[model samples]
Target: MNIINRAASILLLLVFFLAFFQNSVHGRPLLLSMSRPKPDDAALFARWLVSQSSWGVLNTIASDMGGAPFGNVVSFSDGLPDKGHGIPYFYLTTLDPTARNALKDQRSSFTISEYAIGTCGKKDPENPSCAKITLVGKLKVVTEDPKETTFAQTALFTKHPEMEGWPKSHDFQIYKLEIEEIFMINWFGGPKPLTVDQYLQAKMDSHTVIA
Candidate 1:
């Protein structure tokens, strides 16, 4: 009887370990884990994308690729968890082409999809109603000031904890999109006419933007 009990205990432990390994997301917990707002709430929808997403396609004018527009997948953050301020920030290194291109030409746009957030069930990525935002503006490197770096790092590490362990030789630096234009589509009929001010200042809990 003791032998059988020991075997059962070992089996249970193995099951638990297997389950834990399957669920672990790079040894860090996900943040801003929340459901999406209604499609009518444009502000909330935009905020939901910026705050909840861990990465997006950062568009820049490629110098090596015959000056064509280049889009690279990159991780980003605005603020801590749900406290996002609506300005997307990134951690990049010169070793990558996106950072080099941005330095030469600040004109850029960053795009995120609602489908990535899993709110657009059964909808194709090209569907306008599925929701996507392209923030157009200048990509400027953030000042290396200690205070600013700390704030950005805290915001980034909260969501992408694995980033903290990147090799130091790569010289990762903080960059931000100085948004000047907003283009978002969250519902049918047409694209939403949302401005930069309306997007940034839109209260998270308020639904002022009509579909």
Candidate 2:
């Protein structure tokens, strides 16, 4: 190869290594924020975590398990990536205990972790700095409004392409968390004091850039 082409090839390889170091100590996003919000900015931090996560543990008031807070890992979405509305939506069915429990009692909460996105550095998953949130509210099935179903289907299929091909026999239905409270810890001290109003209304227009 010519000397100029050889020089360009080396430069590209160096650039690639730098990018690997920068993104994963590290993280990447598309309907996601590039960085964590200041811990004190409770509202922003809560919103950032929720918008970036595609799934979390959903808790419900169990009936068969004797009313315990039964937690189940499930997939979810708030909106389309960074364009979220700060409300989490889900795809579930009666085949799962979570959905069945929700029908008997709507009281529920959903929890997500920043560590799942690889932005927690080397921190342990349970470490406070890794960032975790529990959104408390009601989990209800969507019995009406076809439009909401359409929006949810698009959101789910986009993030989890595999769901599109899942067996039709499973009969998955749409569900949502009507958030009434918020609990989050992105750093030290303790869970930041944030309320549902502050969380849902926090502006994210500045963080709307997508991949």
The CA lDDT of each predicted structure is: 0.84, 0.83
| Tens-digit lDDT track of model 2 for 1-211 | 6999999999999999887766655344333443667778889878888878877999998879777889999988877767677888898979999999998899999999888876788999999888999999999987698988888778878777778888889998889999988889888888888888899888887653434
Stretches of candidate 1 off by over 4 Å are: 1-32, 144-146, 205-211
- Model 2: CA > 4 A from native: 1-4, 14-33, 208-211
- The Cα error of candidate 1 at residue 143, in Å, is 0.6
What is the TM-score of each predicted model, taking all chains together? 0.81, 0.85
Q: Tens-digit lDDT track for model 1 on 57-152?
A: 999999899999999999999988777889898999999999999999999999998767666779998897788999999998999678877888
lDDT of 2: 0.83
Minimal lDDT window, size 10, model 1: 25-34
Q: What residue pairs are clashing in model 1?
A: none
* Model 2 pairs in collision: 23-26, 23-27, 31-81, 31-82
lDDT of 2 at 43: 91
